[model samples]
Target: MNLSSKSVLVTGGAGFIGSSLVRELLREDAEVTVLDNFSAGDPSHLAGLDGSLEVVEGDIRDSSLTSLLERKEVDCVFNLAAEPYIPYCYDRPAQFFEVNANGTLNLLLACKEAGVERILHYSSSEVYGSAKHVPMDEEHPTLPLSTYAVSKLAADRLCFTMYHEQEVPVIILRQFNCYGPRETYPYIIPELISQLSKGPDLQLGNIKARRDFTYVEDAVRGAIELMKCDRAVGEVVNLGSGIDYSVEELSHIIGELMGYDRVNIEIAKERLRPLDVERLQCDYSKARELCGYRPKTSIAEGIERTIDWFRENNERWIWEVKIAPSERIWRKDDGC
Candidate 1:
């Protein structure tokens, strides 16, 4: 279906990738309604967008969602709301399931009630845990390692089951590690950038663990394209760069870009997760075949863009960055 002039609802639209998706949908002339609780999302991310945008500070688990969907006459829904912080999940595993799994069920029920045409459920690559093989595909065995991954996997299965049982036109888009501007959390890319911005010395964990990082814009574009393709409904697709980079390599690249000839690397146990996925690499061939999707941004180019954003908006993401050691690790009580 064409997105032009369509009414779209983006859950968690105030977030990093969600905000970027909201911007792109507006560019397509789609009337956008953002439903976010601002738990991990920032209100300022939606600031200064030129479009028919409606912002709702609400949660996906709200009982009023059906009424809201009907009132707005939303044509499509992009579900991105979730408790995504990994370390925090260890502290509150139940919250992750509540938001990622049960909350998704609530949205699905609302869509069923409101007769919403389509729903693109944003899932995470963590559901696959560490790769059992190179270039993980949609059919990869889902052996999630952490609570966050298991919660996401539960949501994914919910979407798939809902599509078959309730006939809710749902597409599960499993997005790999996404990094770009407006990211609130202290993930690897943002964390490294934050540290490097301050000095050359870096403290990190599991530098050998590899991940396939996809630029936010590219990931959003892939989702939009899949939504536009009818064949993608009731299917799971992977969105990624089709390449992987180790954390150590990523740090060095960031250091080099920041004009640091050599940066001090300190591997601290406090930064390591007990149940960290060792490696992640995406196989997006299904996306290519179904929707003619291919990631357009390279890692270096994306990192440069991210660095530029952080440089211009230091106050936006600068905060007391926290990692492992359990004590310093982010908890659910820690206000996002």
Candidate 2:
């Protein structure tokens, strides 16, 4: 579908990645409508973006999404809204199923009813769990360990099921860890920047765990590129840097960039997830072949950019948010 002049609905458009996608789509001249509950997404992320855009405060689980699609004459839908915090899923497992699984079902049904031409559903790399092999591909065995991963896997499979059984024009875009400015959660990147900015001493957990971190802008570019590729429909494609880095390695690099003098690091039990995936590396060969997807940002450059953003935007929550690494069971706190 040619995105230019097309009507697009981006659920969770106020989110980190979603907002970035909105910006790119607007540059493509697509009329965009954003649906979000504002639970984790902040309206300020969408600020200063010029486009034919509308923001709606709503949930993906709502049945009324069909009417909204029809009313807006939306040509395509991008589903990014979900309960994405891994630790939060531990306490509210059912909420993950409700939002990530059933909520996706709602959106698919609405697309069918509204005759939306295509829908791109965002799936997480966590669904793949630890890599049984290096550079996990789309066919990687399903071995989700956490409640969050399980819920995402459920929704991931749901998108495939709808595509095959109901003929829903859907595509599953499974992206790996994305980090950049305007991030809502205190993910490793933000947390590291947050902690490193304060002092040289660092407290972290699962430092040996490895992940493929894709910069937010690169991820957004890949999503838009896939949306324009008709062949990507009914397919699941991976978007990532195709390079993995351990948390410990990441910390040292950030420390060097921050110019820390003999940095001190310690393992903090509170920061550990009970069933954390030890490693994840993406195999985006399918995406590369189908849509010419290539992640342009290197980890060092991405981190540098992120650090610069935080440096300039110190008033952001990440700078002031209290990180209780010493507390037992350090709950995911925004420190708002």
Candidate 3:
């Protein structure tokens, strides 16, 4: 599991967290290969690491991925490829199943065929929707409230099954809300920042819902540490900052940070989920004990970093704005 001399494949390496992970791996001198279809991902996000990493522009569900893995002599596989947006999953459940669930199946098969030594499957805290208890841990009963959550949960279990039956060295990390630069999705913090910058009026849905927001860098660091921990095999670890904040509170904070005295808030019915999970706060004791993983960034610090990045890369941020509105609002009649 030592990555120093290993060859790694990071699926969906062009996306938000995956791109960050790719950069870290390259810095550590690992021979990296990235497989991304550019569906919800953009290759431009990975421009800095282009020369150091091999890029394969193809879908994870394609049989070609197996061949590519075998030819590349991949030592380890990190399955970060997924349809991450909840509302998009509601609008396109079949696509969600095809990409998140079946795409995971394809990657597992490819890993097996390539004799990849280890695999780290990225999962989400949404799998433990509406936390049945405070500080939700790996042992919490999973009750996914969205199709996206359900698909990710299914993939997480698939990794567990692969480890038990197929003997693949696979581990799962149920990541909480990870946010940072190059993340174009209209998640709470980014959405609030974008809206506030546009004007004083910010429209959203379910402001009272809370989430455990982990910095993207922290989540990526935790994932890398877990990949080197042999004891993590066949285990599910939660990656989070062990903090929670309501969307309402987060928006207000962003408004203040942006120098706005006050901001107008509006509730748009179309922005609400059909079955929204009210709250999520993680229990990161296992991650800390196992891999010495602790979030190094506070919420305020992380928000400031994200805001700074957005401001510096305003053009890229603005281009992404066009894709955001459609990406955020869920529609039942959209042929999911």
Candidate 4:
């Protein structure tokens, strides 16, 4: 599965981690085609790449993804498409299942149909509800606490069974908390950053919750390396920072770096999830042994980079604050 000059199809390739993977693919001179519905991904995020980068605007559930895969002469597929926002997944569980679970089936069938050489299917670390043990590894029990996590875990198993029964070469990476430019989800880091950037008070819920945050670049790097590793097929591996940071701790760090010492932290009742997973910390040693994965950026460095991105590109994520608050708190609820 040598990626150099190989034809590759990356579904949801315009997304935060996906876009970063797209850049890596282009740098490696792989013929790349990006498929995204723009439901949670912004096309504008992929503003610059050209000459070996092809963009397809479509959904994974539709026949369009299969059709594109058939026509693209692709050697490998990277399945990164999902309805991943936690709060939104709770709001629309059916839609989340439709996209994350069923959509994965569509892509797996397409890959099998196309006889693709390799497929890297990404699952969320949220699939592991909380740390039953510190430094949770590949063998951790999956006790998904949210609809979004359930959908991803479903898809994760789907990929595995399809590999065994259907003989599709699928690799699953249960990615931990990933953050960077163009991250669509309103996770505590991004949401809190948005709130603190625009105003003095940072309104958040479940501040005690903790997670292992991985920078987007490191996550993408690991994914690409896994694509080239033969042992990665039919394997479920975790990709994370291996260190947990509480939301409370992150608020002060982000505030300090952004030079807002006076930023007030207030609990926003509406922002809390129905059943929150309390904590997550990754043990990516299997990934290290298999694909030489070593997450280089520390949390401090990653937060600095993320804050810099938000400061530079306020307009893109500012919509998050406006739309989210208005929908949940400020706007009057009137059934249509």
Best by lDDT: 1
Local accuracy of candidate 3 as per-residue lDDT tens digits, 1-336: 668758899999988899999988887788899898776667787885633588889878998877888888898888889887787676678878888899998889888888888899999999998988999989999999999999999898888888899998898989989888877746777778778777779899999999999899888989999998988888999999999999988988888888889888899999998999999999999988888998999888888898888887664332222454434222111100
TM-score of 4: 0.92
Clash pairs (backbone) in predicted model 2: none
Better of 2 and 3 by lDDT: 2
RMSD of 3: 4.6
Tens-place lDDT digits, model 4, residues 110-217:
888887899999998999998899899989999999999999999998998999999999999899988877664366677767676666687789989998999999
Off by over 4 Å in 3: 317-336
Residue-level lDDT tens digits of model 2 in 23-105: 99999999999999877677888988897999999999997888999999999999999987787777778878999999999
Candidate 4, overall lDDT?
A: 0.83
Clashing pairs in 1: none
Candidate 1 structure quality by residue, lDDT tens digits, 161-217? 989987999999999999998775478898888788778999998999999999999
Q: How many residue pairs of model 4 clash at the backbone?
A: 0
| Pairs with backbone N, CA or C atoms under 3 Å apart (clashes), candidate 3 | none
Clashing pairs in 4: none
Kindly give the number of clashing pairs for every candidate: 0, 0, 0, 0
